[model samples]
Target: MDAAYVFAVRFRLDPDRGVAVEPETFETRLRRPADDPGESGWLFFRDNLWRGDLADAESFRGLTADALGVLVESVEYRALETDREYYDALREAIAADLAPFNADSVDEVVSKYLGSSVEIRR
Candidate 1:
C-alpha cells in the first residue's frame, strides 16, 4: 500500500537571474507511510487539501515558487496513489480523527478532501 500525493507543477525561471535553469515542469510527490495510519503528523491532506484540490492555490503556488525560486505558472493535482490495504486503514484513522475535523463520517471526510483523486494500485 505504498502511497503518495502527486502534483504537476509548471514554473518558469528568469535567465536574468544569472543561472542556467532547466525544465519548465516539475513532478513532485509527498510519500505517505503504508502501515502507519495513526502516525503523528500524518495530516498532510487534511491540512493542504479541500474539496479534492488544494485548499489555497495562491498560497501553495507561493510556497512552491519560494521553494524553487521561480515563477510558478500553475499547479495541478494528479492523484493519491495507494493500495486497498492502506486505504482501509486510512479510513479507519480518518474515522477516529473525525471529531476534530467536525465531520460526520470517514467517507464524508475522504470525499471532501480526496474526491475522485484516489487511485488504488495493486
Candidate 2:
C-alpha cells in the first residue's frame, strides 16, 4: 500500500515551564531522533492554529506526549492530500528545499506536507 505524509506538531502550552519553542530551538543541542530541524516553521503553524482563546485546551484534538517533564498540551497530526495531481508539483518543491540537508528521497514526503509546520525528526 502507498504510504501517507503526516505532520505531528508537538506543543507545550505552559510557557512557565520554560520550554524554548523559538526558532533554532533544536540547534546547539545534539541531534536526536525527536529533534525538530526548524522550530520557525512550527511557530508559524501554531500561530495560525490559535483561535484567540486557549480555554478550549482540553477540547483541542490531539494525542498526549510527555515533554520536558510535563505533558505537551497537544500533539496534533494532519495527513496531506497526496492523491491529487498537484502533489507532483509539491514534491518537487520540497525535494529542492531538503536536498541541501539530506541525501534521502524519503524526506520529500514529509517536507512537502509539513513545509510550513515542522520537519520529521532525524
Candidate 3:
C-alpha cells in the first residue's frame, strides 16, 4: 500500500473592503512524506498560486487583473496511508475505543472528508 496526502486550501479575502470576496479553494492528492520532487502537485500548485513562481512580473500583473487582489490566509492538509503496519495499527485503535466514538474502520473515518475530488487511500 502507498501513502496519499490530501491538501485542502482555503483563501480568505481582505475584510477591510466593503464587498465580500468569496473564499477560494483547491484540493489535490499526492504520495508520501509531502515533500521532494519540486514538481509535485503540492509544490507546483502552491507555488504558482501563492508565490510569483512564473517567468516574469508581467505574467502576475496581467493574470490578477493589475492588482493582486487575493492573498492566502491559511492552508491545511491531511495524510492517509494503507500499508499493513498502518492498517493493523488502525484496527487496534478502532477495536479499543468507546462505542459512541468508535469507527468501523479507518476507511469509514477517511471517507467522511475524502469528498469527490479525492479518493480514500485504500
Candidate lDDT (C-alpha), each: 0.75, 0.36, 0.37
Model 2 TM-score relative to the real fold: 0.26
The TM-score that candidate 3 achieves is 0.29
RMSD from true fold, candidate 3: 14.4
Clashing pairs in 2: none
- Greater lDDT among 1 and 3 belongs to 1
Residue 109 alpha-carbon offset, candidate 1, angstroms: 0.5
In angstroms, the error of model 1 at 100 is: 1.9
The most accurate candidate by lDDT is: 1
The runs of at least 3 residues in candidate 2 whose Cα sits more than 4 Å from the true structure, single-residue gaps closed, are 1-72, 106-122
Full candidate order by TM-score, most accurate first:
1, 3, 2
lDDT of 1 by residue, 1-63 (tens): 567777778777567756775764555543444335778756777888887898888888888
- Better TM-score candidate (1, 3): 1
The TM-score between candidate 1 and the true structure equals 0.78
For model 1, the superposed segments whose C-alpha errors exceed 4 Å read 17-35
lDDT of 2 by residue, 10-110 (tens): 44434567565554222111111221223233222222233222223454323233323434434344433233333454346446565543436735444
Model 3 bad stretches (over 4 Å) = 1-5, 8-70, 73-79, 98-110, 113-122
